[model samples]
Target: MGNLSVGKADSIPTRPKRPLKPILSDAKNVPRRRIGKSHKGRIALLHAIAHIELNAIDLAWDLIARFSNPSLPNDFYSDWLEVAVDEARHFTLVSKRLSELNTAYGDFAAHDGLWEAAIDTKDNLVSRLAIIPLVMEARGLDVTPGMISKFRAVKDYRSADILDIIYSEEIKHVKVGYSWFMFACASMGLEPKNTWQECLKKFYKGNLKPPFNIKARNLADLPQSWYI
Candidate 1:
């Protein structure tokens, strides 16, 4: 019976061999600050965000498939699956906006940094949750408002509207990650703040850029004391 659970190991879900593309490249080479107050620059910005959302879809599913844990309650699966759905919707909405601009996802080069975070933390569910949703998704919370403002400044209400929706929903996604990470820490009798800090030091190889959205992060239960 290969179908049987072997002493509590959950069946591992298969990983996608490759991400849906715009030809992955180094983050350094990715065109930076393309969100200038111009039509072409706006298109570049949307393409970049669409790329992140597409990778987000895969990353959510990858977490479910790569880190299946039978002992963990069903809520964990439910959380990530729900996140996957949200990310899918986000990708669809942004891609539609790209279509409106007579453009699509592959029109520009994108950094592999997001998926790289997923790959690096694939081995540990805790690190994966910490790095992906908490660290990565949390970064979205930090930067999105500026994007929304940028779009509004250029009178691109349609794109701004879409980003508004994503900004709201992403708060919940980050909350889910924070909740799960805290749950894991409690299970192992570790302090949440200390353990999270340690994980960031060990697993996240990059520094968190400042000018953070402290208020939004506070809403998600990630206090400044932990990061600062």
Candidate 2:
């Protein structure tokens, strides 16, 4: 597991536990963000984002452990490991912010959809890359600036600053996914854009809500045509 060049799907845990709070539940059951208007709502929003980061950490590692492609370059593992580190940092930053608000993670209910996305795409690396990074994390690009603004609007500059950092780093994470997805597509002789569309049609369970961050997505090398 320590060696990036060596990988075995069976060697890693199928599900790893973390110290997340408030217990996992259905997505519909989790509180919606009215994060700017009230203290408790803000706490709920942070808790939810923390839960997301924690799952993201697991997702990065899980991608490494679940994929057994011998043709995958060593840098694939390194990239995901870097993503895992970023997610861990994100979790710690958000958790610390939560504590500053006299709250903690697991103090609010969180949805399990992210892990479900992982499970659904586990059998295919292309689909995994499409759904998790392209669709899901890309959604982050769409929404995060507004979250930053919301935090700033309420004068929660500390929280806004943390989100600013996360937002910037996540673009690189998406680029890593985009690069690897293209690699896998080329290896299989499949057109990258078409295969991406096919994967999204097959495995993605939701629509991409609009008002997209075209600039951010472009920065990540994901063109507007991919989403629209």
Candidate 3:
């Protein structure tokens, strides 16, 4: 007497991943000068922002479609849904900025590097959290402030504005990762700090660089002990 919805087995949804070569080709062909020099080097800046946004879109979708474990609570799906929405919004912000620069997304050569990590972390929930949000996306917190200051120096308000939204939302995204990661850690009786240390030593792409946004890490609900 097994439960199968009283009839049919559960089904997983299918969503093909985004194409890469096509996106990169469009990016390469677009002329860089169409963006006004009046914008003070903002054209290049806007293009870079657009590229990150595009990659974020793919990251969000991949998480939802691949991690469809019915045993996880509905809150799990809801959490990811929020992330997908924010990623899409961030994409729009940068895309609009590019338009104001007289350019568009896909106007420069970019790679699918963001999705590569998603695929690598796909097989396990802990690996997914430890890699995607904590290691990769959280790097944005450490790096974006400097980028924002540069844009501000160039008087590119739009670019900085878009970055502000991303920085704020990224805190929440990282928090989501931390929540689930702790849940998984507890479920498996793995000490959180030791597990993260082992994961970093094993799967981390590079050194866990410093200049971290300590405040944001706390807000993201990372173990307080790590911050101290």
Candidate 4:
């Protein structure tokens, strides 16, 4: 329960994800920019999806690693462990389907935007949950239906189906974030809603930009009363 007892992950007080080398991943062997849309497009998209899942792996594990403290209840590690497992499942599902699509992870260029948020929040768990699951991953929940439609429109049934499952599960994941965020605030005797907006402003340097899904934010238990 020591402040310094987070396990297994390379500790970082700043830029926790600066070195997401994916040492356990062989995605580098996968080809980049394969051709022909017959299955190539599906392959590329799934490749990107796999990359996301990979980043999610580190993100969840680091939660356990960076925040294993007496401030957290005994159950906190188990919750983050569950997240790690779920993200593993997601990566496997997308990777398997990507093979079916005739490509694999690293078969296309991808960004590390998701992990950037992870690094940004390494200073505190409340701010971590606020940005990771609430702001960023919550957006994943909001746009999933459209992703399904786009996949459907292109007739990639397997891709569409996989995305559907990820969509449904992501909601529960964000709910996990909301639950812990409130718990942290309540346990620390801080105002949950006020801290939420304050953290958002502090992290993003002001109001969150447009294209925000207020509905999904509400679903994540970010009540409108919290807006600054």
The candidate that achieves the highest lDDT relative to the unseen native structure: 2
Candidate 2: segments with Cα more than 4 A from true spot: 1-4, 11-13
Query: Candidate 4 residues 43-105, lDDT tens each?
Result: 665776787788888888778878777557756777777878888899999989877766666
Provide the global lDDT of candidate 1 against the true structure.
0.83
lDDT (10s digit) by residue, model 3, range 1-228: 123222222443333455443254443454353233375346766676666676676666666666666666666667877888898899888888778777777656664555566666667778877877877877777788877777677677778778888999999998988888898888888888877767767776678678787777878877656533
Candidate 3, 175: how far from true, in Å?
A: 0.6
lDDT of each: 0.83, 0.87, 0.70, 0.72
lDDT of 4 at 194: 76
How well is each residue in 18-41 modelled by candidate 1, as lDDT tens digits? 546677788776666466666688
Residue-level lDDT tens digits of model 2 in 1-228: 356357476666656776656677887889877866578778888888999899999999888878856778888888998999999999999999999999888787888888888888888888999889999999999999999999999998999999999999999999999998998888888898888899888888767789999999999999788778
Point out where model 3 deviates above 4 Å: 1-16, 19-41, 224-228
* Candidate 2: clashing pairs of residues: 21-106, 22-106
TM-score of each: 0.90, 0.94, 0.81, 0.78
lDDT winner between candidates 1 and 3: 1
Model 1 clashing residue pairs (backbone): none
